[model samples]
Target: MRDTALGAPNGAALPASDVSAAVGLVGLAGLLAWIAICRSFPEFVGAFDLALPAERLDGPYAALTGLIAAGLPMVLWSVFVDKVHTRDSTGLDWNKRAEGQSTRAISFTKLTGLWATWAIIAAVYCIARWYWEGNYLFAMQILGVAIVPMVVLSVPYILWLDRRMFQPRDGAWHFGAFLLAREPWDREKIIGHWRAWIIKGFFGAFMISILPGGFTQVVNADFGLLASQPGALASALIALLFVIDVQIGTVGYITTMRPLDSHIRSGNPFLAGWLAALLCYPPVNYGLMSAGGLLDYEINAPGWQHWLAGNSMLLSLWGGWMVVLTAVYAWATVAFGLRFSNLTYRGVITNGPYRFTRHPAYVAKNLFWWSASLPFLVTSGGPMEALRNVVALSLVSGIYYWRARTEEAHLLREDAKYREYHAWMAQHGVVTAPLVALGRAIGRGRGEVLQPAE
Candidate 1:
C-alpha cells in the first residue's frame, strides 16, 4: 500500500493497470441490456431477425450477440477512454512511420507466416477426430465460415499496421524468414511464435465450442420463478457468471491485436506451465477428471443442492456463498478486459480482484468446487468413500496450485514489473501476503529455500 512498495523503475510510482474496471463494467452493462431486450421484445428481435438467427437469440450465431454486447463496449472503452492504442506497449510509432516499400516487405513476410500458421491449425482441426464430435463440431462450423473473411482481411490489416510498427520484424516475421529460407531467424522467436498460436488455436476453439450453452441458459432463464427456489436460483446465477467468464474469456483469446495494446508479448514457455494448463481442459480433462477418471471426486456425491434439499434457510446461505465464490471467479476474468488467455503474458494486471490475490480465479474456483460438491457428504458411500472423495478433490485443488506456481514462474521470468508485483503481493496483498509468509515458514522448517522461478 505504500509508495515505496509500488514504485516503478527510477523510483517513480507505477502507473495503474492498463485495463480499468470500468471497461468490464461497461461491457457487463451492454450485455445486461441486450439480454433484457431479448427477453422483453421478442417481436422486435424477430422483425429484423437476420442477426438474431435463432428464434430466441440463443443459438450459435445468436450467442455471438453476447460477444458484440460484451466485446464492442470493452473495445470502445479501451480505445477511447483508456487510449490503449497510444500505449508504448503496442510497439507502434505513429509519428515515425515506416517507408512504403519497407512496410510492404514486412507485411508480406508476416502475412506469409500468419497464413501458414492458420493453415496448419486448420489442418490439425481437420485431422483431429475430436473436433468433429459433440460441442467441437459447432466450433469447426463457425471457423469454417469465417476462414475466408479472416484470410482476406489480414492482408490489409497487416499492411496498415506494419507501416507504423516500431519493429516490424517481430515473431511472425522471424517465423516467416525461417520458413522462406531467405534470411536467418531467431529460433527462440520461432518457438515463441508457435507457442502463442498453439495456445490461441487450441483454447480459442474450446472457448467457442462452449459459448452457446451458457448464453442460452442466461437468456432464457426464468428469474421470477428461480428467485423462489434457492437451488435453481444458485444454478442460474452460476450459469450467468460462467457466461460472463466464457464471453469475456473468448474476447481475450481473439482480440490479441497490437493496436489494442493487448498482444501476447510471450507465451508461457515453461513445459510445466503448458502441462498444468492443458491437463485442466479438453480431451485430457475428459479422460482425467471425468466420472470414473483418475481424479473423480464426485463418486457418490449428489452435490449441495441435493443434500440441503427441503432446508430453505441453509440452502439459501450456502447458495449465496457459492454465488459469491463464482462471482469472484468471473470478476477475475473481467479484470483482464481483452487480455485473459491461458499460457500467455499480454500484460501485468494489478487491479480489481487481482489486487486481493495473485490468482483470484484459481482460488475462488477451487473453493467453489469444494463447497458446491461437498466431497465429504456422500449419500451411499460411508467414511472410507468420503475420505477418498476428499483426497481426490484435494489432488484436483493441488493441480490448480501447480498451475498458479507455473504462471507465477513464467511471469516472474518475463517481466521486471511482474517481479515487483510478486514482491509487493508477498508483503501487502489482501489474500496473498499471509499465504506467502506461511509458505516461507514451511520452507524454512524443511531447510529448503523456495524462491520465485527466475
Candidate 2:
C-alpha cells in the first residue's frame, strides 16, 4: 500500500530501512553549514579588515553551491560508510573490471542511445513554449551550457561504466539497437528506456527552474522581524523547508550515476502512473489546478491567515503546524538522499517517516493544504462557493491519493523487498497498522475479506 526503497526482508517483525536516518541529516548538516557560511562570510572578512570584496554570498550561485555542499557530503557518506558502490544494485564490479576492449562495441550502441535521448529531450525543451519563458528559461540556459560538455564527456563515461557492469546490454543499448535496426532489441526495454529519460528530462528541468526562487526567499528573509509575526514567520519557515526540498530534489535528479548506486532501476511503466504525476506539474498543473484552472479551489477563500487574524494563540499554533507539515514533506525528500524522483524506482527506503506510514510526504502535504487553505471559509459568494472550494480541494487531495496508489503499484511489482515491507507494515507499522485494520473491518462489513500477501 506504500512505496518504499531498500529495506530488510519479509517477516512478522517490522523491517529496517536500508538507508540510515543519518544520511538525510548528513545532507541537512551540509546545507545548513553552507547557509551559515553564506550568512557570515562577509562579516568574517570585515572582522579581519582585509582588502577583500566583503560582500554577502546570498546570490543564486551561492544557492547552487549549497547543492554541492549538500551532495558531496552525502556522496562521501554513501561510498565510505554505506559502501553503496559495491552493492549488487549498482551493477558495478570494482574488484573485477571487465576488459574495456571487449565492451567497446556495446558501449558504442549505448552511447548512441544515450546521446539520442538527450537530443530528443533538448528538442522537446525547444518546442515547449514555457521553457523559453519565466524560470524555465534559467533551466534552458543551464542545460544549453551543459549540452556540449555532456555530449563530449558521455563517450568516456559510458565506455568506462559499461566495462565494469556485470551485464552491460542495458535498456539504453536495447534502445540503440532498435534505432539502428541492426540488432535484436527487447520491446519492453526500449519502452523502459524512453520512460526513464522522460521522467529525467521533464522533472529535471522543473526542479532546476524552481531551485532559485525559494532559496532567494530564504536567503533574503529578515528573520528577526519575521519572528514577531506568526504569519510571516510561518511563511519564511515554509519557504526555507521548500528551499531544502528543491535543492535536495535537484541533486536527486542530476546524480543518477551507477557509481553512487542511485541510478533509476525503472520508471513506472504504467500510463496511469505517468498521467497521475504529470497532472501535478507545469502546463498540466496550470491547466488543472492554477488560479483560473478547472479545479481551482481558492476562488473566494480568504485562507487560514485571514480568518485567524488577531487570535494570537490560534495563529501561532496554526502556523507552527503548517511548518511541521512542510518540514515532514521536506524530510521525505531528504530521506531519499540521492534517489528522489517522480515515477521511478531506484530502491526501497523504509527509514525516516516511512517507518510510520508509507506516504508521509503526501499525507503531510495534503493535511497542510487543508489547514492552510481553509477552503470552507470564503470571503464572498455563499454556501455554494464554500462547497465548491471544499470539493475542489478534496479532489486535489484525491489526486495525491491517486499518485500514492500508482506509486505503490509500481513498486510492488518491481521489488520483492517492497512486498515484504508492505506486508510487515500492514501488520506492524505504527500508522499503517491502524489504517489496515480499519480497511479490513470495512471489507468485512461487506462480506469481503482481504487476502494476505503470498
Candidate 3:
C-alpha cells in the first residue's frame, strides 16, 4: 500500500506509474481535439476562396470551439497533475528532480510530436487542395502553409544550434560576444589573425544587411503584394530589389567599418555618429517607402504610390554611389595600412577623400538620402514630390554640419598631430576650406565646439 503522508520519512508513496494512465488519456484526447479543429477550420479550406464551400460558417465556428475546449482542458490537466505530483512528493517540487531533466525531456518530446503532427496535416492539406481545386491552388496552399511557420521556427532553431555548436565549455567568448567586441589596434596582429576577422565581418554583414531585407521581402511577398494577374511577378521583383539593397548595404558598411574602427574608437563622436547613421539609415528609409505604399506594385499610377516609387529610385541611386565609395575606401585602408602617416594624425584619418573635403563620406551619405527621395518625386510626377525632397535634403545637411564639428574637436585632443593636419589642410586649400570654416562658424555659434564627452 502507498503511504498517504506527504514527504514521509520512509519512502512509501506509489511511483509515477500510478498516475501515468490517466495523464496519457487526457493528453491523447486534447491532441485529437486540436487536430480535429485544425483539420476542419474554414481558414484552412477557404484560404484561396476559389470555391464557395457548402456551410460557410460551420468550419470556422467548429474550429474556434474545438480550439478553446482542447486548449483549456490540456492546460488545466497539466497544472493539476503538476500540483498533485508536488503534493505527493512531500512539498518537494517534482519539477526540481533530476536537475529538471525530466521536465525538459517531456517538453522536447511534446514539441517534436506537435511539429511532426503539423507537418503531416500540411501534407494532407496540400493533397486535398490539389484534388479539389487543381495544381495552382495546391501550390498556393503549400506556400501559405509553409512560409510563415518556417520563418518563425528558424529564429529559435538558429539560437539553439548556435548554443549547442559554437558555445565553448571553456571561458572563450561566444560567437555573438566576439562579433560585438571592438577590433584591436595592431594592424599586423589583425591581418595575421585573418580567421577571426573573416568570421566577425561575415556575421556582422549578414546580420546588418541580408537578414532584415530578406525577411521583409519574404513577409511582403507572402501577404502584402496581391496580384491582379495569377502570377505575383511585380511583387517578386520589388522584393528581390529589397534583398539586394540589404546585401549591398551590409557589405558596404562592414568594409567601411573595418577601416574606420581605429579612428572611430578614438572618441570621435562625429565619425562614430556618422558611421552609425549610415548603418541605420537604409533600413529606416526602406521601411518608410514600404509604409508609404511605394513598394506596392498593385496600387499604381497615382498619389502616394507615385511619390513612394520616385523617392525609392532616387534613394537607390544614392545608395549605390555610397556603396561604391565605401568599398573603395575600405580597400585602400586595408591595402595601405599605416602607410598614410600624414593622413593619420593622432590616429585620426584625414587623407584620400578627407584631403578633398573634411567629410566626403558625409556628403555621399547625404546625397544618397536625397537620392532616395527622388524616386518618390519621379513616380508622383508632381510639384509636391519636389517640395518633400527639399525638406529632406535640408534636414540631412543641417545634421551633417552639426556632427562634423563634434568629430573634429574629438580628434584634436590626441595632441599636435590632428591640429597640424588641420592647419596644413587650411593653408593649402587643397579641399574647400570655406566649407570647413563655415561649419566651424556654425558650430561655434551653437556653443557646440567644446562640449565634453559624456
Q: Pick the candidate with the highest TM-score.
A: 2
State TM-scores per candidate.
0.94, 0.94, 0.32
- What tens digits encode model 1's per-residue C-alpha lDDT throughout 260-300? 99999999989998889988998879868888888999999
Model 1 steric clash pairs: none
| Ranking 1 against 2 by TM-score, winner | 2
Model 3 earns a TM-score of 0.32
Per-residue lDDT of candidate 3, residues 176-244 (tens digit): 223334322334332323332333222332233223333333333433334332223333443443433
RMSD of 1: 3.1
Q: Regarding lDDT, does 2 or 3 come out ahead?
A: 2
Candidate 3's C-alpha runs over 4 A off are 1-265, 268-346, 368-377, 437-454
On residues 380-452, what C-alpha lDDT tens digit does candidate 2 reach at each position?
9999999999999999988888888889899989987787778777767787778877877887998985422
- Residue 163 lDDT (model 2): 86
